[model samples]
Target: MKAIFLVPKDYKLTGGMYMPINHYVDYFNRNGMIVDEIIELPYHKDNTCKGISERLHSKLSEEKYNIVGFTLNICYMMLRDFQLHKNSNCDCTCFLVDSMSLNMDSVIRNESIGKEYIEHILKFFLYELKEKYCLRNCNKIVYVSSVDKQYVLKRFNRDILGDVFVVPNGIDLPNEVSDKLVRNENDIPTLGTLTGFSQETLNNNLYPFLYSIFPQIIKEFPDIRFVIAGRGASVEVEEKLSHLDNVDYIGEVEDLHDFYDKVDIVVTTVKKDCGLINRVLEAWAYRRLNIGFSKNFAAFEYAENGVHYLSADNEGEFVSAVEYAIKYPDKARIIRDNGYDLVKNKYSWGKSGEVFLDIIENK
Candidate 1:
């Protein structure tokens, strides 16, 4: 079988969005199928509907693929204008990393009502309509997590004629486990988190943990440190972190492994219940103790509260979880080992590829 993937022009090889497409291409080619990727024109204010339709039509006509896949960001507007799924001969599939409606909802509920808030409300309605059109017309819909799939289904409420499949995000394991998991005699016990510096994450995840939760943790363990790393931060966030004594804010990391190695415990501060929790998976893959909010863990139904990793729902629980990790190092090692085993067994790129291939071929 032959397949083609349409991705946004700005898509990078790293990060959550590109992982599935990268693995799918490798998996299909290794299994004697031809797979290719096309970088679509960047969407901008100047691009017209006619131009998008013409470009997409020309591209589709150039190949005779059995499956044509589209990343949701690049194709949502195109799908609305061209109805490419109805016009094309091959099976059209829409790949969603997360539900845009849910993301916009998070911004509305959390962010202050201003220009950005009003803008998100407008986008919420736009995405709701376009997503409905794509889900109804496409032959198949692929979601990165069950949480996203169920949210879309419940939000739309209309009968979707297409087949829906959940293909969870996968990670690439390191060749050798780093020795950083073993703490030094004089090193400070540190807790770390990595996330994008978007306004939504800053308000919902980072600020809450830093302002509300971290102060309490500091009161209990005055010597402990916190490390933060991600893409970018606003001036206000940077100033706040600068004032904090032991909090080290590394602006952006070149490699995530280096960041994981520096911290003793990984805390995922995301409270939103949508999208795959990549930080939890990365901590597990690196063989480090992970503590995350109970709500965010809903993204991974297979992960248990006490078995796979520690769960904290409130400030008090989070403080206690950190305290437990510090006081009982041996027990924390056991939990980390369990988490490592879970990632090795279930969350590999090869495994995710096989499931995606099965959906494409058998479904």
Candidate 2:
């Protein structure tokens, strides 16, 4: 048996799509499979679709693989070429990185964007057609969230329901969360939130929460520090938050290990989109208090409100959760401990690898 992962050029060994794909490679090698190669296909840098497609087609013809998995936004030509040359023994699978339809809806509804309505509608339709064709043709379609799997099933009338599957994101948990505990030893409790907000648009998911909810929380707890991770903070967003004295804007962290280590609690803001929340899982693995809405915990079946982690629906609730966590240290520790235990038991890479192997092998 053999399997190969066809990944995009931007895939990294850090979080996101790379984590699960890395686990899948381990699974294939451990379970008597000879295919441990991951082919990185370049993304469209030249803005010319035809040139990229030609290169992908040429690359596909060179590989002799049994099982090939496609990541997000894979070139149409690569898929078409694989379909053309696919043999009886070979299999094709796709991992829905995120809900494409839902993302398209977000773009269409975004007032800040400048694209014409008719243009967006046409692009939406074409994307749907391409996704449907890929899903119908693939041997298996893996979704990071059950919500996305159900959405795809409802959107497409094809008989691909049985072929679709859900494989929640996995993480590598440490034996103990000493770094978090050490951070908690500090006098001031720190809250961290990661986002990629740019100056060009307000379409970033972190905009609403940062603009609306964070200010209120800062007022309520003047002493508490708010750490902003990742790049793309708009000038407007920065100006809006500049008056706050306790905010720290640490831009573009290479790895979240050090970031998670320093933060006492993790704050996940409510966004327009819903899927696998990697930050929540990372916080759990690090044994930190993760506070977010109920939707953020949708992918984690074991997550319990105020137990495995805290949940907040509105600005008031978000403020209160932070207040409670800061004022009552014992309860916050309990929540963090429970989250750590939950991830240790259920979300390990070994278990995720086994599930992926079973799916790909059709066991």
Candidate 3:
């Protein structure tokens, strides 16, 4: 089957959207589908909305693709896609990717009021707003997480444009984690974290605080190292962290193999956002334990306190999780073994690919 994917030109910073699009493009191609990539630039130098509109207008059933897939995240992109779906003369199935419930979930609301508002607005929209417009436009809808799937199904009999499907984000796991005995030989208890925190999100937090604390961690486990992998660290984030002798800032790594190789544990000390951090999956794929902050992280089902992830609810808990991950080396290896298996079984791209292909083929 021929499939053409329409994705936005999201820079690598938007980790959630970026990785899933990349994964499907490559994965579907591998699994007997002829896949084509078409990106809608985000107001780049060469292209304005007019140019993108004209571009979308031109590429109809003219291509070899038998299927038309509009893969994007956020409400803003929906404006363009709604028109694209409205305009197409193609016979191809219109597949929509909305991994999370975008309509009713409040991005800004805290727990108590957020739930009250979320439940009301979510119920209302699944009945009113989304069902009337968005969900009705496609032949199939794909969500990257199960929370997203359950929220939509239990709330609305709203027939999503496509057959409603869930293909949770996947990992490309290695065959085997090295036995615990060999991990120390390579690198002992090194923890790594990826930060795309530009001036926008962390005006002055994440990296600065992390750098300061690393020295204390170094004092205790002098052999322990830290790898900082990401693209949008502010010039200030780069400048301050550069002086820290222990932190290794490897900028914009295309493939995660080397970064995952050098680390024993991974960290995601995020102060905000949820619905499956890509780095957590990366750690799982590599058979490494993860440590993440616990606020708004309720969306993840697998991130238990000690089993799959070591979570820290506050700064004290953060320090303690780090200390625990560093101290008990055997526990870390066991975490790696369990995590690797979990990802391979439940979250590998192969699993996602198999399910999604069946959805697309209507099998």
User: lDDT of model 2 at residue 204?
Assistant: 43
- True-structure RMSD, every candidate: 2.7, 4.1, 6.4
TM-score per candidate, chains pooled: 0.90, 0.82, 0.68
- Model 1, span 280-350: residue lDDT tens: 88888888888978867787777888777899878899889887776666677788888899989998989
Among residues 3 or more apart in sequence or in different chains, the pairs in candidate 2 whose N, CA or C atoms overlap within 3 Å are: 197-232
What's the C-alpha lDDT at position 114 in model 3?
49
Higher-lDDT candidate of 1 and 3: 1
Worst 10 residues of 2 by lDDT: 179-188
TM-score of 2: 0.82
lDDT of each: 0.76, 0.69, 0.59
Worst 10 residues of 1 by lDDT: 179-188
Per-residue accuracy of model 2 over 1-363 as CA lDDT, tens digit each:
566666777688445767777777777787876664676665433345455445444554666445554554563334554452255535666776666765565557754445565676776786676677667567677777887777778777564634887788788875555545323332457888776665323444565666778778878877778887776666776776676567777777876675776688888864535478887888888888898877778778777898888898889998888877766777788888999889889888788777777887763
| Stretches of candidate 3 exceeding 4 Å from the true structure | 10-33, 36-107, 110-133, 150-163, 174-188, 201-226, 243-258, 271-273, 294-304
What is candidate 2's local distance difference test score? 0.69
